[model samples]
Target: MMHNFNSDPFYLTRSHEFDWNGNESAGNGIQHVDSADITSLFSMHNGIKASNASGSLQFGGSLGQFEKWDDPIVADHTSNHNEKLVKLAQNREAARKSRMRKKAYVKELEMSQKRLLQLDQALEKARHQAAKQRHSIGRDDAFDRAHARWLGEHERLMDELRSSLLSGEGDDTTVHLLVDAAISHYGDLHGIKSKGAGSDMFHILSGTWTTPAERLLMWLGGFRSSDLLKVVEKQMQNLSLSEEQLVCIFNLQKSCQQAEDALSQGMEALQHSLTLTLSSSSLARPSSGDVVDYASHMATAMSNVHTIQSFLNQADLLRLHTLQQLQRILSPCQAARALLAINDYKARLRALSSLWLARPKE
Candidate 1:
């Protein structure tokens, strides 16, 4: 009575030698099972266990065998995703920094504009006040005395230079001292003019220190340095200058001319700007019923005029440098001659002014 179940997973089969009473052992103790069948049964049992543990076979191999096959692909996808996240973060940070820079730049620009406006207003107010009152802009009695003293010194030095020239081999030391003094003396005039630039802006801007004849030749705020070079050249013609000296003079003249041209252009532009500022109808736009901002307009005009002082300063420096350089190029006697030539030219202008003034008027 052994069971025969071939459909079962265990594949148990009954022994063919068993009797109906299940007493195969009645005659021969027990029926002997085939060793090959036992072996096949145990092999099937082990195969089913492997299939259960690994969730069935796949393409003739266990499921675990293919598990590592997709691991490399998953790892690659994860790495790519991390890199994208890093790039996105970098882009966001860059955008944030750029926005911050733009904001700061705009803020600074606005602040600068505000400060510039304030400065202009103060200047305009100061100029207006100066017109109503007498301010000591370095033009006190002491300055007048100093100016007179400077003129006398100029006369004395010129006389000494004349005496030195009349003597044989003119005093080189006197010539050197004269040039040095001339150069140094400009500082006093420059300082006085600078003081007046802010307090008496119009007077300094005009040829206030010059006679009418001198003013006729005035450029910017004073005489052009190039004109002085011409005088020096004319005076040295009798000296029979060497090629090097002439070339040096010509080069200096060219440089002075170029500088004058540049300053002229700048001054023209500044004049245009000042004209617009001064003549702007915003200060008197009552007809339009719009509120006028007088301070703003005046400030702009004052600012432009203030820049004229800087141009005057540069022109003064050019004249000083021209004289100093010319001194270097000329011999002591030649320099004395140049100095005398300049004085004579000035005297001639004064004579012309005197004759013009004395002319019979209708």
Candidate 2:
């Protein structure tokens, strides 16, 4: 019968001698294995064992167990993997830094844009102010030029009027009436009226007293008392003086003296006020307020001039009335002498006025 060792438990007992390399014999009728065959068998067993361990540890394993599979090739693969991870981390960091720099640059650009916008606005504002200032200056200059031209024209007209008066081209009576009418028109325009007869006389003297000293000297030269006295004496020889006439002459002299006194006082006051205003340092390049004040002063001076002119007209009327009265009272010879005296006085006055006007203002 054939031996059934596969089924016999005692056949493969632990005490039985066996040789894995087939270099030794078992205590049975087994054939001896060749050394080369034994080598092949051992190689097959190792290959099977390695395959089993690798398969078992495939999904999950400890670091030590994984390291057991380490060889030159495996080590090189790990090194390549680590290098790739390092490069990826470096790339991530570089990207992050780049993003940060980009953000900063964008912010800087935004700030620059805002700054440029502000500068543009500020420049525009400055330009506007400069333009406004230039416009204001232009207007002021134009007004000043116009005012100067008006003043020149006014002075020329005054000179012409003075020349006509000295030339005796017009009758004194007609001139006096015209002056009165002009003064009334002026008063109406300005809404000014005489407060009283005394004030009217005061205004007249004040206006005349303010005239430049040179003009006053020229006016004084016109009145020759010596010629007037000669004419008066001749008239007296022909006609006796009445009580009413003598009283009238005395009253006229008293009025004239009073007018002179008022004139002197008004001049003193006006000069003082003018000196204070003109000498002030602040008036040099007068401001708007200063200009207005100066204009007011000029208006006042002109009003005074008008008042004096009105008074002179009235005085002329009075003189004509007085002459008429004398003619009514005197004989024909006395009336003729009185007329001659009046003519001579008028001629002398005209000559004096001409001489005075010809003299330059000092």
Candidate 3:
């Protein structure tokens, strides 16, 4: 009889000899597996059978279970994410290095400008020293002329004494007379007191005592020596006045200093503003590699504007003040003469205008 093998326990297979396909014979002449019973056994095993399969059936020993799939598309997405992170890190490092380099460049430029200013100051000092030396040389020349004249007069007196004595006409009276006259004449020529205990060469040369020598040199007429002295004193007064002229020059110097101060302050303000702009742009925008070039152009324009404004406002004020001071110090005619010699205000204004026009526009 045909039995239901799907639900029959006799249809179950526990060895490779189980006739899953119902083709094997039992030990007795009765067929052990019915079609319905075998179907029940297959259904009980979830439609899987170990026998009558072409290939060996794998049974959950490190295989034959649903696999956890490794998706290639997901792996590509993770790789791209890591690459972007690395690129961002590299960009950050480059930007930091560029900022450091720009800072170093600006510092170096400031140092160079400071050194140039010091050099200018040193040069000015050297010129001042040279002027003083020149004045000193003029004084020395005047002193040398006076000393030579005194020495020549002394030699002449000695020659006269020797001739008179060799001619047998010199007596104690002559010697005394000659010595008295020599001393008197020396005192008067050099403006020394005849009654002084003694006098050195310098005191005799510079002393204002000419009465005694004038009386002794009566035979030579009242030598115009006093007139020569008056002239010398006048020259010394003129030298002193040169110092006054130099004081007037200080007006110009003060003007220059004020102009430079104004220019420096304006430029410093502009530099600060430019630094702020650069910092803001760096932080607010993505790196586009063109910020540096644009920033440089803007910085140059700002610096020029600051410099021009300083010259227009502060330098013009200083220049006008200096001009007023100069006018007060010099007569109208003298000022015109001097200004004409130097090409005058019109030329100066023209030159300034030309320079301003040549500068780049904002």
Candidate 4:
């Protein structure tokens, strides 16, 4: 029947012979059917029966051809989607790491700010302490200068007396009595006894007095010239300090003392304040604005310290002027010695001032 169908050109039909169990026997002929006839067969068969019979019929191509047509397009689409997913995951991880790095940088900046603030505060405190020490040294130098001037005057007087006695032109008995009284008075005042009781006057006249305070007082009390004493006394009376001037001088002394104490206390307070600022947990993390405020406060405090120092310097100048005026009443040699002493003291003070000024600040 298949040979007859194949021999006919217009219609081709191929049939499969099936056993009674409805299964096709081997080699019972797979064959091509015409499209119209296959359509009619499909119309007669239900969907399940058609699918089962599909293998027996010949189509244009096998099922593998359809899969081959779609495979490259589907594979390209899947490759592109997988690449997109991989790129998206990489970008997400990168973004996360970038955020972590940014957070670390911010933390480092915060720590740096805190460290700088601490350094600034420490520098300010060091400056305050240095200023305080400078003022204290200035006060001490002033006192030393005054005392040196007194000692210089005493040495000058001793020299003058020794010269007069050695010349042997003065009243010998009166000079001897003056020397004895001066020595006794000086010893009593200084709580010191002359080492060589009998030779003390001779030693002083020979310019060999070794005790500084005793030598100074002996000079002070040894001047027995009634004429010179009268002249000095009259001059002193003429230049008698007014009650108001005396009070001012006394008040200046008190104020200087108080300023010294105050400066000491102020330095302590400044240190305490800085300690609190640096050591406090809350203040240790100060912001930019807080740092600015602290700097301003330190500037104000430094200004006040300078003002006090200026006043102290002015007071010292006035005291120096007063000493100069008093020294004028002494003999030329004595006055010159006193001035030299003052100059020496001033030199020392200048050296100290220079040292303080040159000290390195934080």
Best by lDDT: 1
Which lDDT tens digits does candidate 2 get at residues 1-89?
97576564323323335464435454655454455655665766675577667653221212122224657898899999999999999
User: How many clashes does each candidate structure show, in the order listed?
Assistant: 2, 0, 12, 0
Q: Which ten residues in a row have the lowest lDDT in candidate 2?
A: 57-66
Maximum-TM-score candidate: 1
Model 4 CA lDDT for position 333 = 33
Candidate with the larger lDDT of 1 and 2: 1
Model 3 spans > 4 angstroms off: 1-70, 139-362
Per-residue CA lDDT of model 1 for 261-327, tens digit only, reads 9999999999999988878777667456554477778878878877887887788778778877877
Residue 352 displacement in candidate 2 (angstroms):
9.7
TM-score of each: 0.56, 0.29, 0.23, 0.23
CA lDDT of each prediction against the hidden true structure: 0.69, 0.48, 0.47, 0.46
- Candidate 2's clash total is 0
